[model samples]
Target: MDTTETLQGILEFIDEHITDNISPEVLAAQAGYSTWHFCRLFQWGTGYSVMAYVRNRRLAFAAYELSSGKRILDISMDYGFGTHSGFSKAFRRYFGCSPGTYRLHAHSNRPFPPSLPGAYKYLIGGIIMEPKFVTLPAIKLAGFAIKTTSVAGENSKAIPAFWNDYMSNGMMEKLHAEKFIKKHDEYGVCFQEDMTTGEFEYVIGVERKDDAEISGEYHVCEVPPATYAVFSSPPSDGANFAAAIQGTWNYIFNEWFPKSGYEYAPNCNDFELYDDRSMPDEGKICDIYIPVVRMQK
Candidate 1:
């Protein structure tokens, strides 16, 4: 799925703040954008207005709780509704059931009356995302993107090795400084080119500056200037990277992006940033980065 880490982070703020009294201003603060910026982005990114996402998320949790056997009053209060009557009334309207009746009758697999967004759960890979707002200028890269099955399967490590071998043919020193900016991070983009099934592009390389020479050895791509939400990743290891990436994707897919107002990027790049500074002497140190553009409604 086309998932934006920024939108994912925004949804995460919603998840973290769901239990509290969250105004759009508070929610925006959590999202690292001003209320105006956040609201616009939220609306643009997600089809819902800010309040809608909060209510829908609260409702998703409410349904989960009910399915798990939590009391209606409890779900309501946890979601910030203080009165049973009010909660039940809203519940019946949104979910078409009285709380008591829902617990007694609704199947374990289903909860709520109906007419709400899907569910979201916490995950491990995206557990450490701390997103920041940034504005980056246009940059260019030289690489090839082939659709891959899944990173866990095979190509994840192999493609980078391919890039390295390609680079090692002595292309980096020959590539121009003005046209390209080399980044240690790798980019892994996932999006739905079709409904249900998703698409992925994994690219690794340095940015090509304007005057850069394009020898037959390289391919070129461009990333334009736009509002970006950046997140920091935990230090990498053979042990940690897989788990962390999985968690991040799970969080982005299962939790954050859907509610953030942004739809999947038509064609987005999921990033894996590396910090040579953080690399342990034993192996390597790196982080993941996914840049996203707002999905049009």
Candidate 2:
């Protein structure tokens, strides 16, 4: 089978076994690819990591069952949720409300977006731009760091709240007063602690002077010299900046990286740059930097 066929098979498997503990190894084997290759293909094809796809589907199913008059706790347990609170939190993130509220207004909106059969359709149909490549020198960054995981869609929720807290806490002025900041732009840098576990440390801060004093409450880290593929979003529309950033990332991973002739550089930093030019409500015009190396032929 070709790539499309393989992906369709995997999707079918997930649909048939929605409640099963579908591990990556099992899915990769069914698709006839190694774990690494399967993950890339699955992510590019579905616009979601394997685990994310499963969780979203399960929640969607729960949404369907909620309107059927089933008890919330029973529905949650049916979908492998160990606790009603856990299920409620996950459901809220997916549907923008608690299960109880969603059931009351069942006609409000579709529980989930349509899952594409394969990546090629959306990737080719979207206007994904070619990124500019730049070699950046080592730079120092200062900000608060939080540990988050990509597993079970946690990072999607945690990272945005991290930025909101950083800005609301007046971190920008504090960094600027120390003269540690450069160009008045903030940076959100992702440091991978363990790729295998999808856990990373995210620092929300500004570029700091090389000799800036470290704070006990905050963090200081150096971004080493590397070649980066830089992607820029269209000018901010003064509304919903987070969603726009999320869209840009979906295009990058699903559409760009697979075709760009480069793979992510191992053990390096990936970051987003935002500046004063950005609107508080809408979000700043942003540039995303991903360290990369030439794809081995």
Candidate 3:
């Protein structure tokens, strides 16, 4: 099958088996790729991770069916969820109310933006993709660090608290990691993981090649050379970063991944292009990069 065929087929299969226990790796394999590979391409083309999309679809369908008179138990079972409460929780996430309440207010505007009637109508986070196909070699680095759970946004207390220390200590004013800076005070370094993916205790740090006399608690990572889809994000007063990231994922998974024959690298950090640099007054600028491996379609 063609790359497009495989991609669309997988989506179709997902829709048909919304209630099945098929694993993500199995789904990716059916698409003719590995688990991580499928995840990347799926996100690249669909603008959401494979699993994220599945969750969205499941809730959307469940909402539809329950409103159309399907029993909650049947609806829950149809989505492969183990119990009605589980289904209800997921449904509330999408509809901003219990399925029962959702059915009552089906025609009303959703209290939650992310769970609105047409919430899934648009893909999440695809702005500023301005992607460029570029290749570069990975290098080594050093910097400050703190360990915290993987969070969808910096809403986690640890990271926000980190900023408290970051500002109080004047770490931002005097960043010792200069080599990573590209242009416009734009540091080549960026965030590399998704917290919502159940990752815990990720380190927030920067890279310094030279002996910058690293202080505080931090570690170093060796970035390998690879091809990437880099997207520029607007500067922020620390808000909307999550939106931009989410939008980028939606665009990649919805529009790019299905069309591209590339797969995602397993067990590696995704990329973030820093555009806002140091000036929040610059109007929120940053870019995101997705790591990829070309597949033989």
Candidate 4:
């Protein structure tokens, strides 16, 4: 059989035996190739090591099973995680939330088997745009903060709601009215507080002077100086602006980071800057800044 057909057959085999122990050696035997040769071929065609693809598939199935309301511990063991803690860790890393949180907030469908060759490109979005690199000075921001987790995309829902509340409930005006405010431009900053839990603090605020006075009611955060890769969301109107921005974020994490030759800088902040271009009209746009360092060879 040809490469495509061989890969498809292996995919089917994996689905059939997902909960069973799967290894590259076994799959290599099934594909009639040496283990090393099979592994290289698999990664080249799928953009994932054989085990990573298998683990992701298993996690996808585990996510779908969450909807059944089974006990998390039992389900974890059923999926070969061996323990609740192990399962939770893997689940949080892969799906961006704990299995329990995912159960409450999201329902996952059975993962579709990817077509061979270039399949990973379509996993998130097909388009990847070039980003402009910049070095930014330290920034001081004073604003409201909400604790949120990336679990089950909770951040995705909470942030928008937070913005709506901020904009509509006079918080936006109140902050803009502050004498300490340096500019009308707003920033949505995400600070990773607990990587183990995928929890972070998200701040919605305007930049302030370094020496500006701050109030007790407003939370203050200072972003350290760092080099950033800035990405502009595709031009979009008011109606689809949120989706466009979310899409760009998905592209950055899923598509760009893997190929960018850079990784997220340690203990740094990533943020979205909203300026006049973000006005609720045609051609609305915003910039996303991610602190980055060159990947070690």
In order, candidate lDDTs are 0.54, 0.73, 0.58, 0.80
- Can you write out model 2's per-residue Cα lDDT over 1-297, one digit (the tens) per residue? 445666777877877887788877889788655555566557656646677777877888888888777899999999988899999999998888999998897733334345454543332225657889999998688778899876666777898888777668886567667655665677888775443456678888778766656667668887888899998765546564655676677677666765676777766778898766565554356788988888666
Tell me, by TM-score, which candidate is best. Answer: 2
Q: How close is every model to the real structure, measured as TM-score?
A: 0.43, 0.63, 0.55, 0.62
Scanning candidate 3 in windows of ten residues, the lowest lDDT window is 109-118
Specify the poorest-scoring 10-residue window by lDDT in model 2: 117-126
Tens digit per residue, CA lDDT, model 4, 42-73: 64455455776787788999999999989999
> Cα lDDT of model 4 overall?
0.80
lDDT for residue 16 in candidate 4, whole number 0-100: 85
As a whole number from 0 to 100, the lDDT of residue 179 in candidate 1 is 42
lDDT (0-100) at residue 161 of candidate 1? Answer: 69
Q: Give the runs in model 3 whose Cα sits over 4 Å from its true position.
A: 1-6, 107-139, 142-172, 177-206, 209-213, 217-263, 270-297
The C-alpha stretches of model 1 lying farther than 4 A from their native spots are: 1-128, 144-201, 266-268, 281-287, 291-297
Pairs with backbone N, CA or C atoms under 3 Å apart (clashes), candidate 4: 96-151, 97-151
Candidate 1 local distance difference test against the native:
0.54
